[model samples]
Target: MATAINVQSSCSEAEWKARQRLAACYRIFAYLGWDEMIFNHITLKVPGEDDAFLINPYGLHFSEVTASTLVKIDIDGNTLDGSTYPVNKAGFTQHSLFHRELPDVHAIIHTHTTATMAVSSVEGGLQPINFYAAAIVPRLAYHKFEGITVHDDEGPRFLASLGKKRMMLLENHGPVVMGRTLEQAFLNHWVLQRACEIQMQTLAMGKPVMIGQEVIDKHMANLSQASIDPVQQGVPEFDAMVRLVDREDTSWRE
Candidate 1:
């Protein structure tokens, strides 16, 4: 059996902080019911380290994850930091490609929520039919599902599909959200999840009214102009959720 390792003592201050934040993200996902029983992944690039990143240890539920338990691995999927738990190969296959290619994308989230998967499997993908959808529709990208994401051959195709977009819906699968920071990635996923949920509900009702392109553009413009500090994107919202999770269980910070 593999024993637990003291990760904080061995890592730098910045990396330790990254580990804590990533662990909290897992707990937040569990709290939001976005976790898929240890199947999905959320990865963050290790601070001050090139070609290295962090991921949840396989076999543990998201709620069981803690700062000390996240496995540090390189872009090529080799586990560093001497973590005993194995890395999820499928998670590595998908997340590594983006981390290697996109220098600006420090955080990546992949989930199999019903609403997101439903939106992905839909014919037209996400439409600008509601406020949440209208805000993100123009930035959303789509990639055809290529079965489970374990194969190395699919890497290039995934990159090509994403291009310069930060969010992508995998046809017949789920969603992948990337961000310059972890908080931004979480916020993006939140918005996308809401949009899909509302779309599913609206479709069940009847033919839904779509938002006008001009209105969506205007809304996006207004949002851009409303930011008090672009660099602090998603920090406030993510911190609020962190506080909620802390109230529930601070074990994730262990």
Candidate 2:
């Protein structure tokens, strides 16, 4: 196993920081019960490197992901760090498309949690009945399911479906979120997962009270105001989660 000192010595300072954050995010996902065994993926772009990004080693469980174990690869799917672990083909297929096309997107998270998948499979998709759902509805995009998403041809169609939205429901599949920062990406996934869980519970009770579009717009406006500070947008929340993860296990920093 590679130690923190060894890994940090081998990478640039910015890249090392990105690796720690991404590794912490994987453990945070596990802590939140958002991981699906060794599947699903969260990727972050290598700072100052246009075509390079970091992804989890193919067979490692989320909890086992450490900074030193992350595999660096270019958008073309070739490993650049010379790690023994292979990159997941499906993960590369999905994440590479967004990273290559969107210059602003520095982080991407894809999940197959039960609530998210359930919402995705529904004909109506996520309803704006809950706080989280209402906020997401205004920006959410949906892509039709095309088998397993490994083929190279599906990339263009997925990008087309994503359009200008940062959050998307892979129809009958799961949710894929893109962010300009890793903090933003984690927060996006957190809210999206909560929205789906609330929607599921609310629907099971009976008829749901959907929020009016005008009210939703107002709510979103308020949220925008609250998030006016770009530097602090998702920082506090992400830092808090990272703290929680560290309390349990700090090996992710390695």
Candidate 3:
């Protein structure tokens, strides 16, 4: 691990808290085996700032990311904080589009897990066969892959395809989800990953037992009315995972 620097004095309270949350997200992603080496990204917008956000510095494993090491940047790709590591340009392009278009989304997760990528490559995208899939299927959208999303021009098409959906399947690529909070973002990814795994396994065996739309709609109605606070929703499970991360290594809290 790199030497963890003390940055408390240098950053505002909001920015510092954002750093801590974003860093914890990185560690949690690593702990859950959701990290894709130094690639892929999870970004959290600064608490009170419209344009500023925190993202993992390129080349650092999610496990090595500490609160002090995350790079702060704006939507224009300018580095706001003094971190020597470069931001992944393609990642910034995709994430920035959402951040700019969707002002309410405070956290965004883009992942390329094996099962999610497998589902993305096939037709039908994400199905509402399972409970987990049903909860998010109503809000999911899809965008065709047009090579790497490195150019600024790609942002418009991405935004157009995304519409208002927070959960998106990137064809031939992977999945991306935005959340109102860091905890929600992590939870969304976890649930989506599990849903994808179930679909892949069931399809391998034979035609899977699919849940009917009426049942899905009934469940979704309750889900829509139900509170989804990352701390309280889904059996209040995110906090337990956070506790597990703290137990393993509290360095992420730095």
Question: Candidates ranked by TM-score, best first?
Answer: 1, 2, 3
lDDT of 3: 0.85
Best by lDDT: 1
Q: After superposition, how far is residue 55 of candidate 2 from its true place, in Å?
A: 0.2
The C-alpha stretches of model 3 lying farther than 4 A from their native spots are 1-5, 228-235
Worst 10 residues of 1 by lDDT: 1-10
* Candidates by lDDT, descending order: 1, 2, 3
lDDT of 3 by residue, 36-66 (tens): 9999999999878889888898889999999
Of models 1 and 3, which has the larger lDDT?
1
Residue-pair clashes per prediction, in order, are 0, 0, 0
> How far out, in Å, is residue 220 in model 2?
1.0
Off by over 4 Å in 1: none
Give the least accurate 10-residue stretch of model 2, judged by summed lDDT.
1-10
Q: Relative to the unseen true structure, what is the C-alpha lDDT of residue 76 in candidate 1, on a scale of 0 to 100? A: 88
Task: Report the lDDT of model 2 for residue 74.
Answer: 98
Those runs of model 2 whose alpha carbons end farther than 4 Å from true positions after fitting are 1-6
